[model samples]
Target: MNVLLVSRGSTHHGGHDAIHRLAAAATETTGVPVRACFLDGAEPSLHAALDAVPEHCEVLLVATHLPPDRYLDTWIRRAVAHWRSTRGRRARILVAAPLATQPALVTAVGDAITGEHTTLDGNPGPFRSPAWSQITRHRRHVLVCRGPRCTAYGADHVAATLGNRLKEHGLGDDVLVTATGCLFPCNLGPLVVVYPDDTWYEHVDAGLAVRITDEHLRDSMPVDGRRPRDSPPL
Candidate 1:
């Protein structure tokens, strides 16, 4: 099993550490000539990473934390296409979840890579286990939409405020908030979603965010809304 562990520059601290540890273990155990690639500040291209894998090798992508959805999906599709074109089939792509959350972006990446919806647990061999799973099973998730339009409307602050509020509520263990690049309906951002119900909210502000944390997230009440559909495929 020839392994390629690709780490992203933009992932959270915990996720970065976890990927490094996994890379070390995989190299030690398999002795399969593992190569580690760190996507540093948009400088290292995904195409270059794909090209780095040798022909006839069994490739596994260990995405401990992924970049924004726009970049992640484009890269996944390109990688799949490239592998099939050159290697005649898609490599076994295994993705570890992000450090904290379980937003639609995570689902999208998993779907794109594995062509399946199930989450990976334990040592899937050559691939390491996700770090977050050991701490707890049930985790609260907050989705921050930072798509091109949403970022233009100050989505970063929305993500920061939600993280602070979750900490303030002393629900850090139970909650994980993440800022994804986009969630479609760019006009309505900065949008937010809460899972496992997959509740979607539009035009979210600091006050509305706090209400979500208190009324729905903290209290376990359903926010009055239906789940939004995925964006139309590109």
Candidate 2:
């Protein structure tokens, strides 16, 4: 049997790292092949993890979050069903209870608070790291529209590809990429807007998105043919 531990992934790196640690520990303790997967906001999504499972294998999916959520559980069920139908090879899937449902976890938390092994420092220190402040202090911010209509046209793929291109050109630190809802030109999606230059590009596919990152984002050269004239800019 194979095990996949699922977490609601974070935008920040640490949260995902923690999930990896838990998966490693679970494997070490049980000698089971274990992997960590995310529900959203990170790569190796639940579907991706399921795809990696060997065909005809019995698989167990365990949620790593505290306080079980009906929405997440329902989504997992639907995702598992979809995966079974879409993949050429199929695996037997079983949804296990979340880790936090264990009574030992509740006792451990109470013990941590009551046993006085924790500290509550009241210092009003820095909210974030200086390095974080530097990384976010970019000259240009790029917004990719991810509205329902845009998503139908592959906006998510566009955003991921654009982000990769920006990083490849060493512009990721200098450029901030944000995913937004309903940029208001659904027919022209997937749309990408760059600022403070206020340049808007419509119908951006992965290939065109890479070009925009290299030519327009890195070299300050806009592809005139792709821009919409009457579009509002940030």
Per TM-score, the best of the predicted structures is 2
- Model 1, 1-234: lDDT tens digits are 555565544656666567657767878888866555443322123444556666556766554443334455345545456546754555555554443355776687787898856767887566556774685644667777755445444455566677788889888878777667557677787788888778887888887778888878789886664575654555
Maximum-lDDT candidate = 2
lDDT by candidate, in order shown? 0.62, 0.77
lDDT of model 2, residue 16: 88
Shift in Å, residue 44, candidate 1? 23
Superposition TM-score, candidate 1 onto the true structure: 0.43
List residue ranges in candidate 2 displaced over 4 A: 113-116, 122-124, 127-140, 144-161, 179-209, 219-234
lDDT per residue for candidate 2 within 21-85, as digits (tens), equals 98999899999999998665555677778878877889999987777767567767866775667
Tell me how candidate 1 scores on lDDT. 0.62
My TM-score estimates for the predictions, one after another, are 0.43, 0.68
List RMSD in Å for every model shown: 15.7, 5.4
List the pairs of residues colliding in candidate 2.
none
What lDDT would candidate 2 get against the real structure? 0.77
